[model samples]
Structure formats: structure tokens, C-alpha cells
Target chain A: MELLANLALGLETAVTPTNLLFCFAGVFLGTFVGVIPGVGPLAAISMLFPITFYLDPTAALIMLAGIYYGTTYGGSTASILLNIPGATSSAVTCLDGHPMAKQGRAGVALFMTTIASFVGGSFGIIILSLFSPLIAEYALTFGPAEYFALMVLGLIAASTISNASPSKGLAMVVFGMLFATVGTDSQSGVGRFTFGSMSLLEGFGISAMAMGLFGVGEILSSVGATRIAKIDSSSAKLLNMLPSKDDWRRSWLPGLRGSSIGSFIGALPGTGPSIAVFMAYAFEKRVSKTPERFGHGAIEGVVAPETANNAADQTAFIPTLTLGIPGSATMALMLGALMIHGIQPGPTLIVEQPSLFWGLVMSFWIGNLLLLILNLPLIGLWVRLLLIPYHYLYPAILVFLCIGAYSVRANPADVLIILGFGFVGYAMRLADLPAAPLLLGFVLGPLVETQFRRAMVLARGDFTDVVTRPIAGTVLALAAAILVWTLVSAIMRYRRGMKALTRNPTG
Target chain B: MLDRDYRDIVAGLGLTAIGAAAALYALFNYNLGTFTRMGPGMMPVSLGIILAVFGLLIAFPALSRSGDLPPLKIRPMIVMSISIFSFALMIESVGLVPAVFFTTVIATFSETRVPLVSALVLGAGMTLLTWSLFILGLGLPISSFDWPF
Candidate 1:
């Protein structure tokens, strides 16, 4: 009954004309960006972030959340149609999605992915609505030591569980932390890395860093390499969008399983849709009767990952909203946005700002429904958007990125920081280092430092005492276990590669 | 030729240099207070040491292994950097219109195949759009055209 009443208040808040309009605009812009290969939700959100300052906090969060999930819905279009992933999370979709496109089953793939994504997203939303309040209530009992231990786990997991080498990811995370220490320290009031510059007193602007890395840096990397395969226009027509009876029968179970996997993974800190989608794809393949057809226009293959990614997208908010620990770079940016609005996200956020929290949650459902309405009939329009030459598109993106950075603080210096980070970001990409962990670290570094200091104080400077507490001990143990597992896997992989090389004896 | 992972070696060394520099600077400049009442320098120094250790961990194994370096397209990097630098220079000093126009011109040419006519057109179009969207529609405090005498 309480949940019902709370949901009613949420629906009332979400249906306001102003909030609804911004939600639509956000999803529309998200879809536009996601249909274009090489641009992701991160870039799109960063680009539009400056404008959110003018909006009411509730509306601002609703729109940003809309863009976050809307991308997952639109990203599959490019993967199926052009074999190019519109977002990093959509990369796994290209495996079977493109094959389906090749076999004139593009319409069926697109249709099923939409339905699967909706089911997955709804499941995640249900989990989010039910679990977030409970999690927040439980998290209230956490002391500074528990928070510090949990943050350590998050940072280490982010670095180790990625596609990059663990050391490179850790290096990036540490670099980000180092950068975060630049400004005047809040506790001591001493300038650490300011170098006697006034602008350095505040450290770097979040928008500048985000736009530089994900926006301008991405454009630099993708400039001469973007490829778009011709999409069959007929497949996008309404008449062709229906899946066969057999395809529908095969899709439902995998969709449900994908939703379950995605919700669990997404609820955990330091994991997101990219990992969830890949896991779902592998799981579906392993469970399939005819595994030979796994990558060859398999309906289950397309459905499972699509559903998982969308589900993961919805649930990824759990850690960010409830505990103020963002699992991914994008979630970190969302947290940054909340901080910018002077709304501190943590256990008390739900109680203090119930309307804001519930309104944003309700907006997810509206946004998902809007995506379905937009993608089905407007599928032809998005395909045509692919025809816009990269030359034309990149210039506009660069312009918007510069303006976005500038508008953040109306400071030319911030624009310069964007330029500097853009170069650094390009270098990181060249060196095969993951940038996501760095971003997560940059946002969370200051918070982690504060918690660590508090924990030490509470323990009377006895680090061992802090670790001996039950919650902190268990969480730290989990972090240590992850590190051990990563080391073992790395050694095994190296050994396997060595054996393969010895057996081949090339040349 | 030595069969070594140049990418890992170079990246590792770079990380080491940065981490060591930060640690040394913080140690010299800031106070490293006791754990109970920690100073600002405590976090940076520890994080810097961790980073340097990770760098060594990455580089040491690669000394005996072979790995390919990723392709570096220096053209786009240089071109985009220059254009953004120009935008930063002009945006506050001169105005938004000139900044957007010039940025559009330089950024578009990074493609090399963009015709001169379309580049100018895009510049004009972007200038107009930014002026309208940012200044007119949003009422941000930036002036559309501020000619510095």
C-alpha cells in the first residue's frame, strides 16, 4: 500500500508537462546520437549537460536518465543495419544482428530486440523500485570504514574486471585520482597541486573532462575509420517488422534469462551494460540446442544481449542513487550532475528528496515507451540519418563539444583543459588503456579520500582495527579475492599462449 | 630487432614518470600528517606509489614478450587539437560567432575531402545556430559578437 501510494506520487510528478517534454527531448536526442556510429550516450549526455543547469532539478535528472536508457534502445539499430555498434554496449549485438541483416531478417531482428529490450528494462525497473529504498535503508547502518572498504572494492573491481590489462586500468585509475587531488583540500585548506593558479583552485570541470575524453577524443579516433554498410530500406517498413512464430517461441525464455542476469550484474558496483550484454550473449550461446547457428542470424543471440543491455542500463542506477557509488563512467557523470545541482546522493537522498527520486524513476518507464513508439515507425528515418557524411557530422559534434565545455563555467580555461585532455585521451586510446576506470576514479577519488580519513580517525589510526569490523572485513576480503582471481587468470592465459606458440613453431 | 612489447613499455614508463613526479612534489610541498588527523598529501603520495608499482608490474613482464603497437593517426589528433585550441582562444576574448565559425572551418578541413564551399557554409551555419541556440534561446551570458578593440 505504501509502495502504491509512493508510486502514485511519482506518476503525478512525472506527468507534469515540463518534465514530460524534457523526457521526450532527451530520448529523441539520445536516439539521434545512438543511431550514429562512434557516438555513445556518454558523449551525448555530456554535450547536453550544460543546458540542464537552467532546468528544475527533477526535470534535469529525468531527462538525463532518459538519455541514458534511450541510447540502449536506439543503439541496436546501427548494429543490425550497418554491423557498426552505435554504442560500446551494443558491440556484442553486431555478431548476430548484422548476420540477420544479411539474411533479410533485419526487420525481425529489430522488432524482437525492441520487445526483448522492453521486457528487460521493465524487469530492471521493477527491481530498482523495490530494492532501492531497502538498499538505502540498509546502507544507512554503514560506518565510514564500511564505506571506505566498499569504495576500495569498487575502484579495484573497475580496474581489474575490464577488457584492458589490469595494470593499465589501475594506472588510469591512479592517474585520475592524482588529478582529483589538484584543488585546495577541503579538510586541511591547503592547496596541493594548484601551482599557484586561481583556476586550479577548483580543479578540473567535470563537463570539460567528460566532453574531451568521450566526445572530442572519440571523434579523433574515429575520424578516418568510420564505415557504414548499406541498410535495406524495405526491411525497415512496418509490414516487414513482424517476427515469425518460431522466432517468437525461441526468444521469450532467453529474454527472461537475460533480464535476470542483467539485473543482478547491473545492481553490483563496478559493472554495467557492456559486460552484461557480453555475458548474456555467451550464456545464450552455451544454452542453445544448435550452437552452430549461434552467430549466424540466431534470433536468440540478438534478443538476449539486447534485453540484457537495456535491463542493465535501468539497474545501473542502483548503486549511484542508493549508495552514491557509481558503477560505471556514465553513472559517475550522473552523480556529478547531481552534485552540480547541490543534491548529495546517498542513503538520505530518498527520504529528503522523494519527489526527485521517484519522478526520475517513473520517467524511465515513460522514456522506454517513447523509445518503442519512436523506433518502430521511425526506423526508416534513423537509417537515412546514417547517410549523413562523417565530414559533416564530425564538425558539428566538435563545435557542440567546445561550446558545451565553455558553457560549463563560461571559462576559456576550461576549454583549454578539454583540449589537453583530448590529446591525453587520444594517447590513452593509442596505448590500449581503458578510460572508463579513470573517469570513475576521478569522480569518486575525493569521496574515497574523505571516507578513508574518517575511518582512520574513528579507529584511532589503527588500520587493522578498521579492517576487523565485520562489514568492512567482508568487503575488503571480497576485493582481495577478486585480485587473486585476476592474477591467477592472467597467469593461466599467459601459459596457454606460451603452449600454443611452442606447438605451432612458426618459421 | 628486440621482440618486446613497446606499447606496454612506453605506457608503463610514462605512468612511472607521472606518478613519481606527483609523489615527489606532494612530499616536498604538502604536510603528511598522522593517520588520525590526516593531511592533504597522504592520499596523493600513497596513490602515486601504487601507480608506480602498477606501472612496473605492467612493464616487467612485457620485457620478455612480443606485442603489436596500436596504429597512431597523428593527423586527426593534431588537426582537432589545433581547432579546439583556436576555439578556446577566441570564445572568450573575441566572441562566440567568430569562435564557432573559425572552429567549424578548421575542424571540417581535418577530413581533407571537404570542399572549400561547404566548409565555409558549415561555418556560417554553425555560427548562426550557436548564436541562436545558446544566446537567444537559452539566455546564457555569452555575447554573440564581442569585437575586442
Candidate 2:
């Protein structure tokens, strides 16, 4: 009964004319960027931050959140049609989705992915609505020590779990932490690392840095390398889109299982849609009665990962909204957007701003519905979009990036920050270093530092006193265990490599 | 180019130098207070040391590995930087129109295939788009055109 009332309230807030329009607009633009191969939702959202400056917080968040989930729906289109993943999370879709396309099943694959995305996304929304309030209520009991320990666990897990080389990830995290220390220290009121520059006093603008790292950096990396393969639009006929009875029968169970896995993985800190989809794909492959059908045009392959991808995308918001802790880089960027609106997200956010929280949640359903309607009829249109020449597209994108950076503070100097970080991002790419951990580090660094300081003060400078608290102790122990395991595994891998080299000198 | 892959070694050394520089600067310029009454420099110092240690860890084992450094494209980097820098310089003085046009024109050179005429058309089109979208539609405060002294 309470859930219904809350949902009723959400519907009332979401159905406002202005909110509906922006939600449509967000999903539309999301599909546009998602259909294109080079651009990701991160860059798209950052570029739109300037536009959000003029809108109300609710509308801004509604639209941005729409784009967030909407991308997962569209990303599979490219993977299935062109064998080029529109987003990193959609890469696995390319494996079987492309094969399905080759078998004159492109229409069915596209249709199934959209249906699976809706199923997964709807499931995630249900989980979010049921779980967020409970999580927030539990989080209300957290003190500074518990918060610090949890953040430490988040950072360690993020670096070690995601990256192949744990040391490199840790190094990037530390680098970002060091970078976060550059501005005037709020606690001590002392300027550190400013070098007497006025711009350095406040440190870097999150929007500007995000644009540089994600937007410009992405353009720099892909502008020269990409060659869009010509897509065959005829295979995606409207009549061919309808799935046969067998296709429907194969899809339902995987869709259900994928939603469960996606929601569970998405709620956990230090994971995202990409990881969820991969896990779902592996699980599906292993469980299949005929495993050989997997790298071929297995309909289960298309359904499971697509379902998990959208489900994970929606549920990744759980930690971000409820605990004020971002589980992934994209969530961190969204939190940064909220901060720009002068809204500090914490346990009190839902209680204090019930309309905003519920309205945004409800908008996800509308956004997903809008995507289904839009994608079904507009398949031909998006394929045509892929045909646009690269040279013409990039310059226009560059203009938006420059203007977006400048619009953040109306400061031209911010544009230069994008330029600087563009180079840094490009360099990191060259060195094969992951930029996600760096971003997570930068955003969470200050928060972790503040919590640690407060915890220390409360414990009268005794580290053990702070760590020995039941919740903090358990969380910190988890962090330490992850670190030790990562180190041990890295050593074992190194020794195995050495033994391999010894066994075969020049084989 | 060296025969062996120095990618890890170079990257590790770069991180080590940056971390060392930050740590040394923090140590020299700021006070390191006690744990409870922590100073501003304390976090920086500790983070710097940790980064340096991580860097060494990355570099040491990489000594036995063989790989080649990935090629860095200079053309896109240089062109993109120049165009953005020009926009930054022009936007405040002349305003959004000229800044967009100027940046677009220069950015077009980043790709060898684009002809000169298309750059101008794109510049004009983009300027109008930004003008209508940002200034007219959104009511952003920036003027479409301006002249400063």
C-alpha cells in the first residue's frame, strides 16, 4: 500500500508536461549518441551540463538519468547491426548479435535486445524502489568511521577488481587523491599547490575536467582510428522484427536470470553495467545445453547480456543516491552534476527531497517506454546516422565541448583545463592505464579524507579506536583482505610468467 | 625506439617523479600536524608516498616483460589543443560567434580529408546552432557578438 502511494506520488511528479518533454528529449539525444560508435554517454552528459544550468534540478536530473539508462537500450543497435559497439558495455553484444545479423536475423536481434532491455530495466526499477529506502534507513546509523572504512573498501575494490594490474590502478587512485589536494584546504584555510595562480585556488572544475577527460579525450583517441563500416539497412525490415515462438521461449528464462544477476551486481559498489553484462554472458554460456551456439547466433546470447546491461545501468544508482557514494565513474559524474546544483546527496536526500528522488525514479520507466517506441520505428533512421562522415561530425562535437566547458563558469580558462586533461587522458590511454579509477579517486578522495579526519578527531587520534568499531572494523578488514589477495595474486601471476619463459626460450 | 618495451618503465618513472615532486613540495611548504589535528599537507604527503611506492611496484616486475610503447598521434593532439586554446582566447573578447567559427575552422585541419570550404560551412552552421540553442533557447548570459576595446 505504501509502495503504491509512493509510486502514485512519483507518477504525479513525473507526468508534468515539462518533465515529460525533457525526458523524451534526454532519451532522444541518448539514442543519437549511443548509435554512434565513438561517443559514450559520459561525454554526452558532460556536454549537456551547460544546458542543465538553466533548468530546475528535478528536470535536469530527470533528463540526465533518462540519458543514462537510454544509452544501454541504443548501444546494442550498433553492436547488432555494424559489429561496432556503441558503448563499452555493449561490446559483448557484438559477439553473437553480429552473427545474428549475418544470418538475416538482424531484425529479430534488434527487437529482442529492446525487449530484454525493457525487462531488465523494469526489474531494476522495482529493486531500486524497494531497496533504496531501506538502504538509506540503515545508512542513517553510519558514523564518520564507518563511512571512511566503507569508502576505503569501495576504492580498493574499484582499483583491484577492475584493472588487470592492481598496482597501476592503485597508482592512478593515489595520483587522483594527490590532485584533489591542490586547492585551498577548507579545514585549515591554507592554500596548497596553488603556485599563486588564481584558478588553482578553487582547484579544477568537475565539469571542465570531465569534458576534457571524457569528451575531448575520447575524440582525441578515436578521431583518427575509427572507420565506420557500411551497414546494410535492408536486413532490418519492419516485418522481419517479430520473433518466432521459439525465440520467445528461449528469451524469457535468460531475461529473468539476467535481471536478477544485473540487479545484484549493480547494487554492489565498484561494479557497473560492463561487468554485469560480462558476468551474465559467461553464466549463460556455461549453463547452455549446447555451449557451441554461443559465439554463433545464439538468441540467448543477445537476450541475457542485453538484459543484464540495462538492469545494471538502472541499479548502479542504488549506492549513488542512497549512500552518497558512487559505485562507478559514471555515477560519480552524476553526483558531480547534482553537486553543481547545490544539492548535497546523503541519507537525508530522499527524506528531504522526496519529490526529486521519486520523480527521477519514475522518469526511468517513462524513459524506457519512450525508448521502445522510438527505437522500433526509428531503426532505419539510426542506421542512416551511422553513415555521416567522421570529419564533419568531430568538428561539430569539438565546438560543443569548448562551449560547454566555457559555459560552466563563463570562464574561458576552463576550456584550457579540458585541453590539459585531454592530453593527460590521451597519455593514460597510450600507457594502457584505466581512467575510471582516476576519476573515482578524484571524486571520492576528499570525501574519504574528511570522514577519516572526523573519525580520528572523535577517536582522539587513536587509529585503532576508529578501526575497532564493529562496522568500520568489518569494512576495513574487507579492504585489507582485498589488498593482500591482489598482491598475492599478482606475485603468483608473475612467477607463472617467469616459469613459462624458462620452459620455452624461443619456442 | 628501443628493442625492448620501455612503456612500463617510462610510465612508472613518470608517476614516481610526479609523486616525489608533490611529496617534497608538501613537506617543504606546509606543516605536518599530529593525527587528530591533521594539517592540509598530511594527506598529500601520504598519498604521494603511496603513489611513488605503487609506481616502483609497477616498474620492477615490468623489467622482465617485453612490449613496445604505443604510438602517440601528434597531429590530432596539436590541432585539438590549438583550436581549443584559440576558442578560450577569443570567446571573452569577441564572443561566441567568432570563437565557434575560429575553433571549428582550425579543428577541421585535424583531419586531412576535409576540404577548406566544408570547414567554413561547418563553422557557420555551428555558430548559428550554438547561438540559437544556448543564447536564444536556453537564455544563457553570454552575448552572441561582442567587441572589447
Candidate 3:
């Protein structure tokens, strides 16, 4: 009954004139970024960060939430249509999506992806709504030790989830922590690594770091290279969008399976959509009767990963909203945006700010509906957008990147920060270091430190309390298990590589 | 070019220098309070040492992996970096329009050189969009066409 009334209040807020408009704008911008290669929703949302400072907090969050899931849906369009992923999470979609496009089934692939996205997204929201309140109730009892232990688990999970070697990912996390320490220390009011710069006093701005690493870094790497997308114009017609009855028969079950997998992974504090989509794809291939057809335009192939990524996209909010812990790098950015608006996220968030939580939830369903209407009819338009040269695309992006950074503090120095990190980000890409974990580290490092200090003070410096308290101890134990697991696996993998190299000497 | 097999070692060494520097700085500069009452220096010093150790772990290898560092596209990167630097200088000094115009013009050269007319048109269009989005829609305070001189 309470849930219904809360949802009713949410619906009322979501339908308001201003909220509706921003939701439409946010999702529209999200899909646009998703359709374009080399540009991303991370930078786009970062661009919106300064803009959100002026809007009502609820409206701001609603619009940002729209962008979050909207990008996941939009990302698959590029994967299916052009064999390119608009974001890293959509990489698995290319496995079968491109194959389907090659087989002149691009329209069907696009249509299935939309339907699957809606289904998986709805599944995630339903689960998020049901679980968040209960989780928040539990989280209200947590102390500083619990929060610190939870953060340890979250950080370890984030480092190990990246596809790169585990050791490199751990190094990136420490590097991120180092960067996060650049600002003035909140407790003692002393600068840690500021190098006496006034700008460093506030720390590295999340907007500048996100835009520099993901946006400008991407442009710098790819702007010089030229690539053309091949679209099957005939299969791109509206008629081709209605998947055959047989196609629908094969889709629903896989969509359900993928949604379950995606939501589960997404709810974990550090694992994200990229891991979800691959797991979903692997699950579908494993369970199929004819595994041989897994990568060759299998409609199931297209539906499952699409469903999984969107599901992960929606459920990823659960950890961020309920626990004050980000489920993914994007969630960390979202949490940063919320913090900038002076809205604290955590257990008290739902109990204290019910409207903001419920209203944003309602707007997500509306945004998904708008996407269904937008995606199919506008397939031709999106394909046309693919043809716009990157050289042309990148210049406009550069201007926004600058404007967005400047709008942060109305200081031009933020733009310089982006340039500095842009070079660093590009260098990381060259070195095959993952940027996602870095964002996580930068966002979560301070939180972990504060909690650790507070817990220590409360316990009178007894470090053993971290392991003796039941919930905190259990959580920290899990973190220890994950750390040991990753280190062991990394060592085993290294040894296996050495053995292979020794056994296969070249003539 | 640096050997491909030694990339991890190089990366690890770089991180070690960075971590050691941070750790040494933290060691000298701030109060290292006890564990029960951690001072501001506690987290940085601990993290710096961990980073240095991790760096050494990454660096120590028998080196059998094979992955080449892709040649950096120096031209576009240099041009783009310069354009951004110039924009940072121009935005506060000249104003939004000229900062955008000049930056867009230089940024285009990062890929293929565009004709002057086309570049000018793009610059104008971008300047219009930035002004409208930041000043008009979002209402950030800044002059649209100030003369820095």
C-alpha cells in the first residue's frame, strides 16, 4: 500500500511539465551520444553537470537517470548497425549484432534490441524499487566500520572486474587514490599533494577528469584515423523492423535469462554492465541447442546481450542509491553529480528524500517508453548520423568539453586540467590501462579514508574490530577473499603463460 | 622504440617513481598521527607505500608477453592539446566566441585540413551553440563577445 502511494506520488512528479521536458531532453541526448562512435554519455553527462547546478535537484536527478539507461539502449544501435560499440559495455553486442547486420538483418536486430532493452530495463527497475527500501532499512544500522569494510569490498571488486591484468588494475586504483588526495585534507585542512596550486585545493573536478579521459582522450586517439560505416540500406526499412513470429518465439526466454544475469551483476557494488553483457552472452551460447549458430546472426545472440546491458544499466543504481556505493564507473560519476548538488546519497536518501528517489524511478519508465517511440522510426536518421565525419564531430565535442569544464567553477583553469588529463588518459590508453577503475578510485578513495579514520577513532585504534564486528567483519572477510582470489589467479595465469612460452619455442 | 615485452616493467618503474615521491613527500611534510587518531597524512602515506610496492610487483617479471605499444598519433594530439590550451587562455581573456572560433579552427587541422570558409562556418556554429547552451539556457555568467584587448 505504501509502495503504491509512493509510486503514485512519483507518477505525479514525473508527469509535470518541467520534469517531462528534461527527461525527454536527457534521453534524447543520451541516445544521440550512444549512436555516435568515439563520443560517450559520460562526457555528455559531465557536460550537463554544470547545467544541473541550476535546475531543481529532483529534475536534475531525473534527467541524469534518463541519460544513464538511455545510453545503454543507444549503445547497442552502433553495435548492431556499424559493428562498433558506442561504449565499452556494448562490446558483446557486436559479436552477433554485426553478424546480423552483415546478413542483412540489421532492422530485425535493431528492433529486437529495443524490445529486449525495454524488458530488461523494466525488470531492473522493478527489482530496484522492491529491494532499495529494504536495503536502506538495513543500511541505516551501519556504523563507520561497516562502511569502510563495504568500501574495501567495492574497491577490490572494481579493480578485479576490468578485463586487463588484475595487477595493472590494482595499480590504477592506487594511482587514482593518489590523484584523489590532491585536494586539501578535510579533517586537518592541510594539502596532501596540491603542489601549491589554488585550483588543486578543491581537488580534481570529476567533470574535468571524466571529459578529459573519456571524451578528449577518445578524440585524440581516433580523430586521425578514418573509418566508414557500411549500412544495409534495404534492410533498414520500417517493414524489416517487425521481427518474424519465429524470432519473437526465440527471444522472450533469452531476454528473461539475460535480464536476470544483468540485474544480479549490476547490483554488485563494483561489477558493471560490461561484465554483465559478456556473462549473458556466454550463458546464452552455453545453453543453446545449436551452439554453432551463436555468433552467426542468431536472433538470440542479439537479444540476450542487449537485454543484459540494459538490465545492468538500470540495476546499477541499486548500490549507488541505497548504499552510497557506486556499482560502476558511470554510477560513481552520477554520485559525484548528486554530491555536487548537495544531495547526499545513501540509506537516509530514500527515507529523507522520497520524492527525489521515487520520482526519478518513475521518469526512467517514461524515458524507456520515449526511446521505443524514438528508436525504430529514427533508425534511418541515426544511420545518417554515423556518416558525419569524426573530424567534423570532434571539433564540436571539443568546444562543449571546454565549456563544460569552465562552467564547473566558472574558472578557465578546469579546462587546462582536462587538457592535462587528456594527455594522461591518452597515455593510459596507449599503455592498455583501464580508465574506468581510475574513475572509481578517484571517487571512492576519500570516502574509504574518512570511514577508516572514523572507525579507528571509535575503536580507540584497535584494528581488530574490523574483523571482530559481525557485519563489518563479514564484509571485510569478503574483501580479503576477493583480494586473495584475484592475486592467486593472476599468479596462476602468469605461470601458465610462462609454461606456454617455454613449451613453444619458435624455429 | 622501447621493447614491447618490457612495457609492464617500464610502467611499473614509472609508478614506483611516482609512488615513492608521494610517499617521501607525505613522510616529511605532515603529522603522522597514531592509528586511533589518524592525521591527514595517514591515508596518503599508507597509499603511497602500497602504490610503490604494487609498482615493484608489476615491474618484477621474466618478460615473455608480446604486445607492442601503438605509435602515438603525435600530430593530432599535439594540435588538439594546443587548441585546448589556447581555448583555456582565450575563454577568460577574449570571450566565448573568439575562444571557440580560434580553437575550432586549430582543432580541425588535427585530422585533415579543412578549407578556411568551412572552418569559419563550423567555428561560428559552435560559438553560437556554446553561447546559447551555457549563457542562454543554463544561465552561466559570461560575455558572448567581449574584446580581451
> Per-residue error at A455 for model 2, in Å?
0.4
Of 2 and 3, which scores higher on DockQ?
Answer: 2
Query: Candidate 2, residues A87-169: lDDT per residue as tens digits?
Result: 66788999999999999889899999889988999999999999999999999999999989988888888888867789998
Error of 1 at A103 (Å): 1.5
lDDT tens readout by residue for model 3, B14-81: 78888888988998998889999888888888888888887877776526555455777989888998
Clashing pairs in 1: none
**Candidate number of the best DockQ:** 2
Model 1, C-alpha of B120: deviation from truth (Å)? 1.7
Binned by DockQ into CAPRI classes (incorrect, acceptable, medium, high), candidate 1 is medium
Instruction: Encode model 1's per-residue lDDT on A286-325: one tens digit a residue.
Output: 9898899988999999989988988888898898899999
At residue A236, what lDDT does model 2 achieve?
85
What stretches of model 1 exceed 4 Å from their correct place?
A226-228, A492-507
Tens-digit per-residue lDDT, A13-95, candidate 3: 89899988888877877777767775655756665566666788878877887776667667788788887777777778888
Model 3 misplaced stretches (Cα beyond 4 Å): A500-507, B1-4
Which tens-of-lDDT digit does each residue in B31-115 have in candidate 1? Answer: 9999899998899999888888878877766665677887888788778878999999998888999999999999986777889
